[model samples]
Target: MTTKTEKVEASTKIRPRIGRWEVDDHNEVALLGTRCAACGEVAFPEHQICVNCGSESTEVVRIKGPATLRNYTIVHQLPPGYERPWVVGYGEFDGQLSVLAPIVAASRDELHEGLSLSLCVGVTKVDDDGEEMYSYQFTPTKA
Candidate 1:
């Protein structure tokens, strides 16, 4: 018997992003946003010009904890880009920021608008080569 090993590179799938997301060992996920110090408006992915007040002073911030499922839909058809056959949606957090993401509930019955939810980091799927594509999703919270 012989054992073989293979080294895999991740450049074939979705491009990796930086500085716009946060993940942990527990699989919680959320969009990283920035806040404008001069105008006090929150911006996703660190905006230099404040959209609301036109200010240039901003700082990085993370939107975590306590999000509500605002709306969702099951996507059967994938665009020329992106994944398919997934329930994708957006949620409004307790921090008054609305973030759109994939719905990772066990079933459709588990999703509803205004449902309390939690963020988690997750692997989208495994490729034919057994490579894992990681992404984020929101799950409904318990009563």
Candidate 2:
């Protein structure tokens, strides 16, 4: 947990994280989530308190993919951590879940809603000190 120098405790065992929620892209391989017992609403980044019903009681879960694309954007501009000219946007799945992720669409013409995709773990980039930064990306089922 130190800056300027990077060390990954265990690369093979490490998973994605949003705040304290650990996202394991294995069994339930999409985005890890939580559902509210009170309202049956879903949340990403796994919230303990449901925003929909304000319920403290919740079930931590993961969304398996075979997801249908909701909507997409071809990014001619890339963010600080992204490669230039990458496509990125929301990938909507069943159960009302949507993930804001990079879409590995073959071409801009091929991007659209309802395209089938799956979750993949990959090295996004190498940082200043040569640490391999990893993340989840949704790619077309065949690609």
Candidate 3:
């Protein structure tokens, strides 16, 4: 039998499901993206080559938030391994960067176009190894 401390330790071992994101001690999430040196375009998940200019020159940059919700969909038909419904949306930041991420909301009525969202990290699922997998998600910013 596992002790209580062991369970806590295991729960704290979170692994990011995607690359280019970091979580602080407070659980605040910061997404890392790449900026094209040639075209000055920014992209998430950090690309090696610039998609806009076709240039290999790129630099890693942090994505600053307060993303404005553009659109969203509530998915009821889940894929294999998913247990419940979830919302996903596109949020535009800085009037240039648009990121598609899962949205965390208490109710469907709380979501709408132009809602301000902030980046956060949470456990999306557990892996076969019993490790918690975390992904970047957007939550409604507290007014």
Cα lDDT listed for each candidate: 0.66, 0.66, 0.77
Candidate that scores best on TM-score = 3
The predicted structure with the larger TM-score, 1 or 2, is 2
Scored by Cα lDDT, where does model 1 land?
Answer: 0.66
Q: Model 3 off-target regions past 4 Å?
A: 1-17, 25-27, 128-130
TM of each candidate vs. truth? 0.71, 0.73, 0.80
So what's the TM-score on candidate 2?
A: 0.73
Please tell me which model should have the higher TM-score, number 1 or number 3: 3
Total backbone collisions for each predicted model: 4, 0, 0
Scored against the true structure, residue 4 in model 1 reaches a CA lDDT of: 11
Q: Per-residue alpha-carbon lDDT of model 1 for 57-108, expressed as tens digits?
A: 8777877856888888898886443456788777887665677767775477
Better of 1 and 3 by lDDT: 3
- Give one digit per residue, the lDDT tens place, for model 3 in 1-143: 21122344455555443555766666566788889999999988788899788899999987867899999998888755444788889989978788988898647888999999998766665677765655778999988
